[model samples]
Target chain A: MSNADHHLVAGAEGHQPSLAHHFSSHRQQYEAGKLGMWLFLLTEVLLFGGLFCAYAVFRANRPEIFIWAHQFLDKQLGALNTAVLITSSFTMALAVRCAQWDQRRLSAFFLTLTLVCACVFLGVKYVEYKHKWEEGLLWVRQFQPAEAAASLDESGTSDQQPRHAGIFFSIYFAMTGLHAVHVLAGMGAIGWVLVRTLRGHFNRQYFGPVDYVGLYWHLVDLIWIYLFPLFYLIH
Target chain B: MKPGPSSGTNLTHHNDQPFHAHVVPVIVLLAVFGALLGLTFLSLAATWIDLGTWNLWLAMGIATVKAALVALYFMHLRYDHSFYALVLAAALLFVLLFVCLTLLDTVEYYPDIHAIS
Candidate 1:
């Protein structure tokens, strides 16, 4: 039923099972798949690149709002999530390596670890979002400055409020929200790979799925690398 | 044109080819991970150094380094076919172009818009 199994059925006939009807060899199929994945990743870059451009525009127009609005974020949590995602990426690479060497057990172990890291990253994101909502820091029109906020003046007045502060939160929510979705998707992909690995579906000759999933996971981590510094550290 | 059973025999040596997927060593992966974490802390430290306008650049610079490490090693781009890397480079170029063009228009109209409002 799985592609791998379909390929296995072909293999039983003394032909390469993983090789598609349109492809002549496993190498050609793998190269085609890799090329397709690269094209998909390029689209992903442009997709997020648009959001990043928006963020840069808003920040350029009102640097002070970014300076003030970002104070509500907890750098420690962001940093922790960064480390979490990076470690997960490492495990993902190791998972691909293990699968390449036909080390099934190690491959499964690393995939499981990557899944755990994704969940932990999402959990931390939830905590951070909950804190933001508690402080009335929603996106756009819903953004409300917390009372007794240090960004306020000595009289605790409203006049000292930064202009267009909500824009910062808007960009923040959009970028990180999309990224969190990717994290969830990455978790699903890794889970699938783990299932396949456990079922003895993947070996050195048929690990394209694992390799592609690992690349996707690394791209997720790569996006967060930029997001962390832009949102949490630049202030 | 449909191929027969013998079609796959030609490309079976994919695993042995140079353009085939690179199986990054465990030790290399760990080293890259360590470097990524180190650069992370270095960027954090840059935030505390009061670089003023330079702070943003420093943070971005360090983040770029970390991103490069992930792409080149962890993502195995360095070992992948050059076409994949070229695709990524082109994507980045478009991103830069999009941002620059948008900013140019924004910068030109900002003063007029600000005065009118």
Candidate 2:
């Protein structure tokens, strides 16, 4: 090679600090970021996996409790939240697409829509949790059912005494509560991306942050897809 | 361990592009949304019918289909590198294993446990 080319490679080494010294190319850095995110997501799956295992074990031990207690959850509200999350996931996918196409305005719009949906989902959850609280259906130790629920037992519908039914609430609170935390975190991440997109930080050449956050948002929707049926559709 | 300095950089027109970064059509995304919402309604409706034990399985089956669609299309796992899909599958496999082993132990000890309770 020429002396000038060699000097170009050797000099100005600190020009782009964003590109780490270890990486040979932009593609490699992007791939490494994606791999790291996926590994983090894998750990997240295992975290929730343990909770799901607990849910299954408890449900197996006391089928009647789930059958009786799940009735307290409003299926319509759960279904509405399910639809809200799924729609938000779609918007998130579109936001990533717009960012890739370098359509900054569209990307910001879609991300805003997704953030709104996350808020709506949480609002519905608050309503559901409030109803449960009023009925005194709480976690194991603090659980105490209202008289209306006790009358169902008197009518021979479900022999599950109020206290015994706490298992379902335990699982419900643990799983959905954890999921709600993720939704809040997702909203924050989406808001961050939305601000950056509006400022034209991402475009066709550099949109990894938007894409990665879209994957995370979709995973949140994936978890809710399973949760709705499990908690609300128990016959 | 590094390659020689004389080695040519493997640059391509697509080098800057992320692997499998397809812009899914807006129609496709909406269609997926509609299908997910439809399935949610189906699961809700299924609860009204007295399917006995089959109810839970049916609901789970529907939910699984919806999850698969979201992962494959919305998350772009279908077009992305297969390694990421493998990672997800591995995580799910371990979850399945955990559930099955717990089920086996619980089923065996259930009666005795019930007697104590």
Candidate 3:
């Protein structure tokens, strides 16, 4: 029977089945897994949601500052990264599919592909971030920004307010930095699962680990989907 | 260690399939993937037109649609039990409630603050 049915059977027992240490019976484990994932997602939303709210707060206060900040960012790279992430999510789904169907080799291959896409994402981010870094745009409080803004042909001091631009960088780094951390964490988790998958540990019924990990990975993509338009497209 | 008839879910009836057991899921997945990409690009293009403040909302709406598709088909929430659906719906509702409450707090003073800008 499915782990699902095990849960049903356990419920039928006079004494709710003894949950295994990991889980008393399969029921407790599955419920726990789903609940845990949701709770984790809830926390993630609050974390990112806080930043989004901050964006709104600041944008409301200084629309011009936010607009000018968007101009300085490389929109093309941001859009490319968006496509890369969407593709990565697709590959991740494929990996889960492979696991669901018991295609070990194929699953491992897709997981590897997902990792490579993650790497490419980080690489592109590195380049964009390096450009920002060299331009003295990393948002150190004491630094002067008008001089840096002047160099960007159109950010003429008249329309630009670089000092206020500091807030944008602060938010940008905070948001994207946290996202990168999630990507790194995802890579580590996926690597572990991919290893297990290669060893033939999951089948259609047992693909929960891979399936859930894929869910987490998609959340990463979900955040980026919002981030792209908020930071790049909106302005 | 516990020798049971099956450790987890009931065994799949793979015996009937001669050589392969996955023609349908693959076809469905690919079709969904293509549609997802199409919708994503459509949303991106739509963003370029001026919809005023509503543009973001529109884009968010389209993106949400894409997300639902992925969650339903690509993620196989489609084939999963109704019980999982209830769990997910509850969690999503809770998230909505959380966002709404947060927004309520922030939106209260938005007008007063916007006047300063």
User: By DockQ, who's the top model here?
Assistant: 2
Candidate 1 colliding pairs? A7-A17
DockQ of each: 0.45, 0.47, 0.21
Candidate 2, Cα interface RMSD? 4.5
Candidate 2 residue runs with Cα over 4 Å from true position: A1-21, A151-163, B1-20
Fraction of native A-B contacts kept, per candidate: 0.65, 0.71, 0.15
What digit string (tens of lDDT, one per residue) describes model 1 on residues B1-117? 122223223324454432235567778888999999898878777777786888888888888889899999987777666777899999999999999999999999999988976
Candidate 2 lDDT tens digits, A203-232 = 554688898898888888999988998899
lDDT of 3 by residue, A1-235 (tens): 5566556655643353233455544334544565567557667766777777766666665667676777767777887787788788888988877775778899999999999999999999999888778776775473356556777656453464634668888788888989999999999989999999988776543466776788788889888877777777663
Better of 2 and 3 by DockQ: 2
Off by over 4 Å in 3: A1-32, A140-143, A153-158, B1-24, B82-117
Cα RMSD, each candidate = 5.8, 5.2, 6.0
Q: After superposition, which runs of candidate 1 have C-alpha atoms over 4 Å from their true positions?
A: A1-14, A148-159, B1-20
DockQ-based CAPRI category assigned to the predicted complex of candidate 1: acceptable
What ranking of all candidate models by DockQ puts the best one first? Answer: 2, 1, 3
TM-score of 3: 0.78
Against the true structure, whose lDDT is highest?
Answer: 1
lDDT (0 to 1) per candidate:
0.82, 0.81, 0.70
